[model samples]
Target: MALRSVKFMTRPFQHNSNRSIEIFLGTMNEGNYLNVGLGGSTQTIHPDDAKRLRDELIKLYPLALAPAAAPASKFKAGDKVTYKAIVGYGARGMDGRKGVIKDVLANEWYMVNFTGGPFDNLIKVHSDYLAAQPVEPRGFKVGDKVRRTTGQSKGVVMTVVETHPTQARGDIRVDGMTGWRMQKYFELVTDDPVEAVKAAIPTVNSGRYLVVALEGANYVPGSKPKVHVTDIGANAEAERLAKEVGGTFHVFKATFEASREKPVIPPVKTTKL
Candidate 1:
């Protein structure tokens, strides 16, 4: 007996510009596989098997894209979505990572899922990150109060428009309504307020903060020392503190450093009398 390995013969079918269907051979042996490859590599399989696999793949593929779709109605602005990157077979890529849908974009592009370092981990994805999740309706109605999970606005639901398949879009009238046009958003809101509230919190970067100490002529021990801040999150608060204490602030370009395995010390400054 010879060792056997199943080979896949894929037939690509274009379904519009955004979607595609592929029919694959159920199984092919090495002899047939090579022969088929030599003749332009296109091989046919049992129509019934092909259709079955195609249908099964269609359903499974969507589930991989949006696991929350199982209970999509339970999704909201702040809900965390677990997105597994769909890499071509045999391609190297990250898989099973998670992100939060900060907002929804046109054509099912939900801005969700992020991964990187503390300041560098920004991952945005589409509705593909979510699968239908279970949801129960809240007593929320039009004109009810709601707050944005991200961004600078909190407001009431202006109106609710129902769409096909139990999906609906809500128009939120935020404080001052600065961007009312962009206020219409989609959420998988359920009747359960606790679940809704839990989903609305954005994913957090749970990394350690980097602290650097500087020593100089004007430096005092814990006297509101002024220091320069750098990297992605080095912001107004850091600059303000540096100015208040009259210390030199120098920002570095790196976002993260290695763990406490090695101690880093700043260069000593010498003054001649």
Candidate 2:
């Protein structure tokens, strides 16, 4: 028999945006082998019951997006949701579309009633394909420094509002734009003034003698003000750092030897007491 193939619609092969499975018929030799394409790879199977196999794959189309061990539903009835990048069937171009979760199902699946713009019906979608409506981030608080994971966009969190019980999303002011952003889009940025100041100072060696380092009168205070010590050859780096920071440092000469010195009391001469 000549090789005959029938291409089926694309389905999610894995929980990734760039990966999918394209089901189709493959070469039918004497043994009748069919090929299933999965994430840029192919698997050959001899199906005694082709109809049954196709039915099983159809049922598993959405579940394949979630792990084998499904997680508990993070959403509940009446929760607002939006489609994630990986959508099923005709869900393409449905970004930013709003939907209401009617019911949460077993195996990380959800029954959502989508509204408006190619979404006038209910869809049984997987949890991986749905995202809760934007709310304040659960971990972020007011006055947190955040920067975008992708580009140079960064801002301080100004407002955080709770819209759902599962998680919170926050608003940030980045590049003169203020709006609620996804928590996963940004990361926290931290800085330690003390560590920064220490890094600015040069490394120096304490000569065989006593070495003392004095901070500049104009030294910028760190989170904690304290002395720092390091080894510098010939005090070269120390001198440069002192000059740059308008500070002064000195190296004293001393002798190292074993001594058993004892404190002596002075004799006091007393008159008539």
Candidate 3:
């Protein structure tokens, strides 16, 4: 049997956009090959880099074409967990609240339902804010009427169920509900855990960047520019795009100073105006 080989003859191509194209190894001077040029004209690749470019493309093309695997989540739906929020009604309003995992949001935060009457809003908190359910403290016993002193269930009166006031802390069941709470979070209803009211606070994101084509480039009317929100993401994207796509990168500055420059000291104009 005779040996055979497959090959693709790349045609010479010129880059049309104002952006700079990164040339790789195994690039060809002509024939359907990737090339860079200006104003829609064809240009040649760096002769020395042609072979490496071809070999790398052969290895990387399969990865690009492979089916992508679904992203994984640490916690799944229906899992009982605790998440922290900026809002709550208690002396320490930023306390952890018990929640049920509703949905796993891609590879990001978890969508949690802070299951209760007062916590109406859905919480999408990151994994860093989550913790295991806390155990009750000592000295809690059954038949005792208690009210939560901290966290989301604050002021909600709950009655102790079966007391285990021994090596393990006791548990209390919420009044009119079946869920049990740790005794450490509460005091006798007669003591009355009065909490200060606080408003909910929202979180904001930073690291946003915007990139647009240069003034003279051809563009569809009203086209939206690119936006990058990751740290150092927008700047890198903007710079790379500016090189190849011939565009201007605008970094979003979060703050600005508006003070006049200080004057250099002069020996005082003591001679009056």
Q: Give each model's whole-structure lDDT.
A: 0.46, 0.63, 0.59
Per-residue error (Å), model 3, residue 112: 0.9
* lDDT (Cα, tens digit) per residue for candidate 3, span 50-102: 46666787888744566777777767888777765444433244356687788
What residue runs in model 1 are displaced by over 4 Å at the alpha carbon? 1-145, 151-172, 179-190, 196-204, 210-273
For model 1, give the 10-residue run with minimal summed lDDT. Answer: 30-39
**Residue lDDT tens for model 1, 186-269:** 333455889767766644443323323356754233445334343334444446557776555443334566776567899999
Report the error of model 2 at residue 130, Å. Answer: 0.8
Point out where model 2 deviates above 4 Å. Answer: 1-71, 87-90, 136-273
Point out the higher-scoring one by lDDT: 1 or 2. 2
Q: Give each model a TM-score.
A: 0.21, 0.24, 0.24
List residue ranges in candidate 3 displaced over 4 A: 1-71, 85-94, 117-119, 134-273
User: What does candidate 2's lDDT look like per residue over 25-102, in tens digits?
Assistant: 677672666776654677777666656786887988845565576565789999999887753454677666789999
Question: Order of candidates by lDDT, top first?
Answer: 2, 3, 1
Deviation of model 3 at 137, angstroms = 18
Pick the winner on TM-score between candidates 1 and 2.
2
